[model samples]
Target: MTSLVTDTRVVFSRELRPVLRDPFTVIFSMIQPLFFLGLFAPLLPDSPDGGSPLQWFVPGIIVMSCLFGSSMTGSNLLYEMQTGSHERMLVTPLRRPALLIGRALKEIVPMIAQAALIVAVCIPFGFELHLAGALLGLVILAGFCIGLGALSYTLALASKNKEWMFWTVQQTLLFPLLLLAGVLLPIENGPGWLQALSRINPMTYVVDAERALFNGEVLARGTLEGLVAAVLVGLLGLAAGVRAMRRSD
Candidate 1:
């Protein structure tokens, strides 16, 4: 068990080095969320209670950051594959599952950091967050990112050398999930079919939970539901990613 943990750490360190060096990548990832905060957030009508629209919008932006950042993790794996580095690493002493776990875990660091940045930026815009609830929300977001990152890596493995297909599949998967989660607007106010679809989307639960958490509703049903959905996604993604890695071996 110790060895597995150690190996995973080593792999994670290796994967994270490049990200640390390329600070611009992290900045670029935040642009979309910041854009929403800057442009779209002002258009939202003030609540009857006089709360800023930022209170409602920030949670969705955090989740959107997770969605976009985590989903693009595969691009790194795809690069390694094209350069033959992934195959080279497979021949090393590292356990097969550790490789995927390491890469997936690395995604969580940038995700949480970006989330923190988003929260910090929103504070001036009147976004309110409870300390304890923010901590729990971060945990939920981490789980979701780990799972999504694993799935992204798994998709990369499946796509192999086909760069075009990998991107196509990623776009096909990301936009619908984003739209269905209603990050840009409330699905409840949309068409009936859209509302129905949002009900089934796990991301919707995540976003709802985040909003509740931001409002300090720590014990809300949405919080529990979102945590469960995020855990399930993590487990499923880890399983699939591990299986895919082992197959590559």
Candidate 2:
């Protein structure tokens, strides 16, 4: 147990250091969320409680950030592949799963920072924060990112630095996942088929949980579903990521 933790920390540290040095890209990633907040949000109807759109939209945007950012992390591994850095690491004594876990762990910090910045940006625009709920919401967001990040690394390994393959799978899935989850728009009023699709999409659950958490509905059914979905994703990602790591190892 101790060794696994240590290994995870080492891997996490290695994954984190580069972003700590140059965070410009991290900030750049925020522009899209802000754009959605500024532009797309106004086109929506008010919250049921007569609140600003931020009440409903902010949490969704946070999840959106987690989704896109974690998914793109595979490209980093692809870069390591091209330079043979990844090959050299494979020669080290690190545990295989730790390699993947550590990289996935690195996703948390930047995501939290971006979430904080987004909240700060939204506050001046009349977005209210539900402290306890927001914190829990972040927990949900982190779980989703860790799982997704691991799968992304697995994809990177599978692609063998073939940028086209990696991007193809990512682009094909992300927008569909994003839209189906109704992050920027409500699917409640959509066609029966669309709403049915949303029901099966786990991201729809997670997004609902974020909004529920943000609204301080701690005991909401969506919250339970979201947590389950995150755990399932993490487990699936770990299984696949570990297999990919072993193959590469």
Candidate 3:
């Protein structure tokens, strides 16, 4: 038990330090969502549902951060592949799953912090939160990050040139998530078929659950259905990523 904890901590520390040291890493991860909240929030039409645009948009912004950070996990895998770090680890006694878990653990803290900040900034813009749901929302968001990060890590292994191809392929992975999730607009406003499609989208589940939770809805009733779907998809994505990585090796 002690060794497991120590191993996770060491890997977590290693993963986190580089992210903290790089200024661009932090800025680029955060800048787009902040820009969306600042510029686009006001442009959204007011709700007859009796809430501000900030209420709806803030959850989406939080989701956007998850979207970006989760995608960036590929970059870490790319670095490992380029530097032969992954190969070195392959020779180590450390459990492979532990390495991935530690990597996911490290990535999630920053994502959660960014999500909290989005909520804080949105307060003036009229975002509300039920304490219980906010807490659960954070968990759901972190779970999404972990699943996506794992997937990205696996994808990076298949990428022949991780650096050059990382950004290009990441855009492809991210756009579908953002569009189907209704980050910038409501899914209901779309066509009936589109709305049905959005329901199955895991990202949309988080966005909808969090948005409802942000409106101070009860944690149990408002979120249970969506949360279940999010958890399932997240687990499936992570499992697929792990399988891909082992196959690549």
Can you write out model 3's per-residue Cα lDDT over 80-111, one digit (the tens) per residue? 87788877886777666667767767768788
Report the C-alpha lDDT of model 1 over 1-249, residue by residue, as the tens digit: 458889899999998998799856886777877888889889999977898888788888999999988888898899999899998999988999899999999988888788889988878767876889988998998889999999999999998968888889888988799889988888878989989998888899999998888778999999999999899889999999999999983
The TM-scores of all predictions, comma-separated, are 0.95, 0.95, 0.88
Q: Model 3: how far is 178 from its true place, Å?
A: 0.9
Enumerate residue pairs that collide in model 2.
Answer: none
Query: lDDT of each structure?
Result: 0.88, 0.87, 0.75
Count clashes in each candidate, considering only residues at least 3 apart in sequence or on different chains.
0, 0, 0
RMSD of each: 1.5, 1.6, 2.4
Model 1: clashing residue pairs? none
What's the true lDDT of residue 164 in model 3?
A: 65
**How far does residue 51 in candidate 3 sit from its true spot (Å)?**
2.8
Model 3 collision count: 0
User: Which of the two, 2 or 3, has more lDDT?
Assistant: 2
